[model samples]
Target: MTDFPEIAAANPAFFVERVLSVHHWTDRLFSFTMTRPASFRFRSGEFVMIGLPSEPGGPRPVMRAYSIASPHFAEELEFFSIKVPDGPLTSRLQRIQPGDPILMGRKPTGTLVLDALTPGKRLFLFSTGTGLAPFLSVARDPDAYERYEKVVVVHGVRQVSELAYRDLWTREIFEDELVGEQARRQLVYYPTVTREPFERQGRIPDLMASGKMFADLGLPATGFDPAVDRAMMCGSMAMIKDVAKALEGYGLTEGSNADPGDYVLERAFVG
Candidate 1:
């Protein structure tokens, strides 16, 4: 496996930079925006390694790969994170405030971008938890609407409270009079809570299995040809596996940076 040079060096001082802003969504979730170095550039759906300075003068740093939540045009970088009580990165990261230093990497790379898929009539973005980050980037880009006649973003969370930014953005973008007309006609936001009662309640796999998702959207459950539909998935390992299997039955093939196809899959976190 290839090891990241800075992380492999285990040097905190060289990588640390000050934080810019922080917004807490729930007890377990928050989003922060940080200054992007002048030289930093990334595609819409890529991720970068981030870390927090360990000690005042210590060398050890806590680092992990985080998907870029802000669009490419944004001046600052943004990340949506979950607070794991004892997670090496989030344990200290969750306590950060503006002016504090957070280490960041130079390059950003991933396989979740819209360019990785062929043009289709409809685009489906399926996510859970922080997995919704990349889709947030894609939905904000006008090119996505131009390429796909219809866009459906389905987010499955453990609770309604966990559906923070996704719900906020969907409402904002689809309601703005300037963008609302196009977004309203082309975009569909489907939110499902696995642990809470809401308009929709169930895992994404279950929704697909029972045809409720398609029926609600007035779409056909089967016969998903690559020419008309494309999909992107990001979530836990189990969710990815289950959703991929379900898509396969409908004739979707997984795509990647090297080979563009009908669908793409990415994990929200290593764990």
Candidate 2:
């Protein structure tokens, strides 16, 4: 038998009840929204553990950390998830529907947030796969525009069908005449795909390596300064490491809750 934490003693206490609504973006990607408990509070970029009710005579519920996709002030909590065919949690999770019960952990925590970085003029949110979730929250927050002059969100996926949320979000933020005027001028959504032909192709690390990203943005490569720029990275472990090393070459340092710095990293999920 596996040892369970004392915190898990009362399963009902740790999990808040929620009604979920699902949206499938592709075979590998999907999103869901759940009713938020009145007392639930979290930072825009934090993640919380979520799971389904355990079956009778089965193993304890398997919970995975998911970044909050909804903005801080939103009444509902949203999550973007990858559907791994045989994943312990996702196998059953992918089948959930509206009005289905979902278990949400009490505490939410992560390093990808505006408060984790020192004030800067530009904010770069680098993501791949479901790693884009936290950035979705940050970008939708009007406060993000107030703190930075520019907000650039780069999302990389395996196919065009996987780029669902970017289009809707970009249009909503950039086309809204009132709430999105500043974001329209300062926000840039750059989408890239590895296995499909799109406006941008290749992984984010490669784009940074070849200087294509900078060239396309019409920004000079010579004056890369961490002082005026802050970045957040979330994706595969390999992708995060590669991107972090690349950012380091440009003088960016990793930051955490204990210290504020030029950049921060959060894993989209435990591998």
Candidate 3:
């Protein structure tokens, strides 16, 4: 007998799977890996609806869309999440342990995908906080490396401790057999801390507007060029709006799955 008969009855689109592992990144952030159904399929940089069973005899399940953090080719699905003490989902989700049951929707979709952007020489992925999740999936895909000459990841966080996957980008990924060689020559990571002191500092828009980010990277000081630059922005609405406006000023156009353009944007899951 399943523990979530209500969920199953409420929607046949959802799959019930067991938690394979969980890692608490910080008091406010965590990530977990879950069993993936053989039939489940999704592209890198996409999101899927996931949730927990509703309280006994109350109502339907409480679900939220979360960006898939792991590459699509992986055997299991991985998700990075923010922990909100009062959030309906995270309050209980933060306590999940190995072997716990989780609900995952069958259909995964989003606009922050490679198919939505036109071909370019440089690919930039900008993210903040848990927004880094989707870009994680995007950065790891072999297709991304093959399509673009350079892959730059710009991660902004309030505190240095919030910078997750530091090892994966700085060291571990470079050691992997598949993409390591390409990553060594093409991957660039720029992590900025706003509230705390760090080697690099400031919000992403501020960094780009001042030409400091490009200067630091030894790239053109004039900033993003639509002709050779394809970009994706995922984070807070404020950051996306600001960055989008700035990109537009530099002649970049937003794109979608239906119409490939110079750039794309998506809102990070807010819990």
Candidate 4:
């Protein structure tokens, strides 16, 4: 791994880590793995601020809050990202390669962690596009299966190719030794596409409101039961508002790290 001793020494608020590998899933999306500092710690479903080091004699480095895609227990940290053609950070972030230096904040925090939700029979992770990042961490966590009887990951994207980490849910997680057994018995992957031909189609809110999601899962077609269901959501601003309203309509209250509730959303990660 490449080291950026200068950047680490220059900034006390963030750590300079080296990129271990990168996978470009599509022209618009990519995922990367990086060295995890022994000192850096965070719960699954949390997000941390990360950025690229500025050029010599340039302005301050650009930073953005990104959900940690790898589980909390993983030796290395992984992140899923979108390639924004002219985005302030993603424009440059998308071109990163293995051995490159990246900056990660010392502190990691978000409302999507399991601690923010009350005990329930099922946990529904709703996400769109790159918002699926944190759920990757949450579903891989063993505590999730223990706290809830089932862990449902519902990902909605524009194209089938944009369904990042599809294999992880479809097969890799089941093959994992630590959470595989639990995942096999309790995990459910419900992926849908908006502008493509797929087995499942429609926005998440529509599916939830129409009870299609429930029927497909073999659950009661009435809708989310606040007493038995817990949820976390991450997505575009429009998607967030829509889904939040839908959840609220079902009597599920929004939650945060301070107050546990029936549901939670990572507002900071919304585009």
Candidate whose TM-score is highest:
4
Top lDDT hit: 4
lDDT of 3 at 171: 99
Candidate 4, position 188, lDDT: 97
Where is model 3 poorest over a 10-residue stretch in terms of lDDT? Answer: 1-10
Point out the higher-scoring one by TM-score: 2 or 4. Answer: 4
> Cα RMSD for candidate 3?
1.7
Q: Model 4 Cα displacement at 147 (Å)?
A: 0.4
- Candidate 4 Cα deviation (angstroms), residue 107: 0.5
Compared with the true structure, what per-residue lDDT tens digits does model 4 show for residues 1-271? 4447877877667898889999999999999999999999999999999999888688989999999999999999999998889989999999998889999999999899999999999999999999999999999999999999999999999999998888889999999999999999999999999999999999988888888988999998788899999999998887788889988988999888899999999764445
Model 4, runs deviating above 4 Å: 1-3, 268-271
The digit string of per-residue lDDT tens for model 3 on 131-241 reads 999999999988899999999999999999999999999998898787888899999999999999999999999998899988998889888888999999998887888
lDDT of 1 by residue, 44-132 (tens): 87888998755546766767888888878777888889999998889889999987767887778999898899878999999989998
Over 4 Å off, model 1: 1-16, 175-181
- Candidate ranking (lDDT, best to worst): 4, 3, 2, 1
lDDT of each: 0.82, 0.84, 0.90, 0.91
Where does candidate 4 clash, by residue pair? none
Question: Against the true structure, what is each candidate's TM-score?
Answer: 0.90, 0.92, 0.96, 0.97
**Error at 109, model 3, angstroms:** 0.6
